[model samples]
Target: MATIQFRLRSKANKNVSIKVRLSIDRNNVFELNTGFSINPKDWSETNNLPKQTTPENKLLSSDLKKLDSYIIENLNTDLGKSILIDSNWLESKINDCFSRVVKTDTSLLINHIQHIIDNANTRKVKNKIGLSASTIKNYTLFRNIISEYQKKIKKQIQFIEITKPFVDKFTNWLINTKNYSTNYAGKQLEILKTVCIDAEKNEIQVAPYSKIIQHFRESEKDRYIQTLSFEELELILNVDLSNIEQLNQFKKENPELTKNLSITPESLNNVRNWILLGCEIGQRGGDLLEITRENIRYNGKNYYIDLIQQKTNKSVTIGIIAPHVIDIVENNLPKKIPHQKLNEYAKVICKLAGIVEVVKGTKLNTETNRKELGNYPKYELIASHCFRRSFASNYYKKIPTPILINITGHSKESLFLTYINKREDKDANADLFMQFYEKLNKDKEPQLKIIKSGTND
Candidate 1:
């Protein structure tokens, strides 16, 4: 039996040893031992080329199988730092195999997905953050779509080459068959395109694989419709952190008290202050951690906070702090705790406040509305983002122009527009009209006084 094994003898060779062994004699006498041929013609099928099929003029099955051999040969080439078979390189090769048949056998794409999961189980590259995991999950979903298509048609598809008609059908399937929204269906289409891109690269005459489905997708835009009310916001602002932090602190100071009950005031205050500061600045929690005494500065009359906003490399400066903000800064901020522990403690604060998130859509609205909505969402369940959203919103109510920009460190109107809401515009307009009416009456009162005195005579 011939077995495949990685040969990594050098650090600079990309040649993955696809060692083929054939022993004619029992005394380890290797009659044939060879590697994959580098030339494409060595594998190309003469029988399959002339009889072109369908609109694409696609190669027959025998031709594509021949092309796979060429791709495998290229992958095994000693082009890099080592003679080792890189796992990623093998994954790439497997992807090349699917690319050949993507226009021919959509089932081959599912095979590729299975290979990815197999690679994961084998610990080829186990990092969860890598491209493989996300692709695998997306492909898994795509596989289900293809399977459903097979069931609907009542016949297995031999070719993966999707035509314009197929794209129209895919759009309908994504909407009605899969019960996916336009946005969600587009995401699936994107995943399909990515897989197709991988396959197209392996073709001798590589055509655009994504062209089959691009027309079916809708443009994805931020359609966030979620927001918290002012009453709910205030309730979030005033969560009962008293007993919770006391217990947390007592765990440290009096471990004995922890056995019975131990949470501290200082810990509670820390939780409140952090939440408040986040709501005040609209800064990400990562940026918030970096905020130290050094960022605070003074230029004669004004106090300023300056830092490079980590998310964007843009430098941001803010001036004008309220007494409440100042008091929290001065008194509430604790000695830096380890980041790991700080996050854990933050969760504790949220839990103590009874915050729980209600997901967007039907299930959450109808089922979890009572538990997750109102004040409950803010204190415990809401993520770090709510603070930023709240801060952007609250600041808009009180400040204008350079002041809001300075405080939030936002420079672009477009960036701020995302944070702005219908309520903000309504309040601004309402206040302007009230002020204008007051001035009109004041201007007329003096003239009316003289007329009243004359009429009185």
Candidate 2:
């Protein structure tokens, strides 16, 4: 049997380094660095350990004992019995022992990320619903991008290696090499930070990269949130789908024009009603697409939308107060519509409604594989999310913020305010603020009093 003993190396500048010595049958000896140095006076030759019982010394003693036990445990294994008991074998065992016991090899940055992704694949959010398909897709994409980043750098990194410099280099690679937008790159970094935080909870050291993620900022141009005005909503509602059938007939007669105008009357009517419903209820596309006749509830006098939001898993009741919503609920309404198709038809509906106001927005230029900001027609910016924002923005002051937030599932007041305030029409925002300013000043005007800087004046 091999006996492990703690010993001190030669003292230099009053500091003595500790080493573990393994004696095999009291003949051959092997020394391993404990990677700890202490004051010469703190070493106790009699006890063969540190002299004091301070917290630091106690931890060091515990580590030394753990390392000693690890070696002994391995020596008793079947593989250990087959190998020759010599200094060379003991030295190799030391490396294997640290790798197994201390997790020095398996705790690489990429490995921890893969573990997080694998665990996320099986994670449930509201105890029943698993992670959304899009979420899983994004995580997989992020993992692939990280792997590519590692390949580009030609080295594997540890968790502790994630620092500001690493973030900077990775961000630049995402923007330049991968052609990701600033907002998208920031989102990827946010996901990476989230994974790093999870790794930290599992006792992984990641403090070096925690603060670096906060510095990532998406440009203001990239932060535009599209919303429809009441006029634009009315225009879409009033669009004549009767001509859509004629257009389809025309497309059949002329095949070349089919690509430009390939809409049908039924599809147009379906998306129009869906958009009207979404604008009235202010629900996300996930919940909007799931709506059915079963979701409508009547409380004797009034009707309400009673459904649990799919994204948040929170039950919300939206009163059927809007005239258009009431009409749709009382009349014929589609049981379900594809969310992607709804978004596509919504843009076409907006365009036909003459909602062509120029606005700044980001678009992925497929030719260059990069996101560039340019002036696009207002209809091009219209999406399913715009319906929710339109509801919030149009009725921000008409309804109580708390009540709206309850329906929207926004947890924070500040975030809700920010969401509603992101308007493309500057004049509309100014008008809302002006109304607030007028209301405040209407009650009482401030009486001005002037005082000279010098009392003599």
TM-score of each: 0.43, 0.67
* 344-431: candidate 1 lDDT, tens digit per residue: 4554555455444653421123343322223333333344555666677765645553456655656665457555532236667578
Segments in model 1 whose C-alpha atoms lie over 4 Å from true places: 1-263, 337-377, 401-411, 419-457
> Candidate 2 residues 302-353, lDDT tens each?
9899888765567899998878878899895755766766776787778767
- Steric clash count of candidate 1: 25
lDDT of every model, 2 decimals: 0.51, 0.76
Scored against the true structure, residue 391 in model 1 reaches a CA lDDT of 70
For model 2, the stretches where C-alpha displacement exceeds 4 angstroms are 1-105, 121-137, 215-222, 244-246, 249-262, 368-370, 422-457
- The per-residue C-alpha lDDT of model 2 at residue 288 equals 89
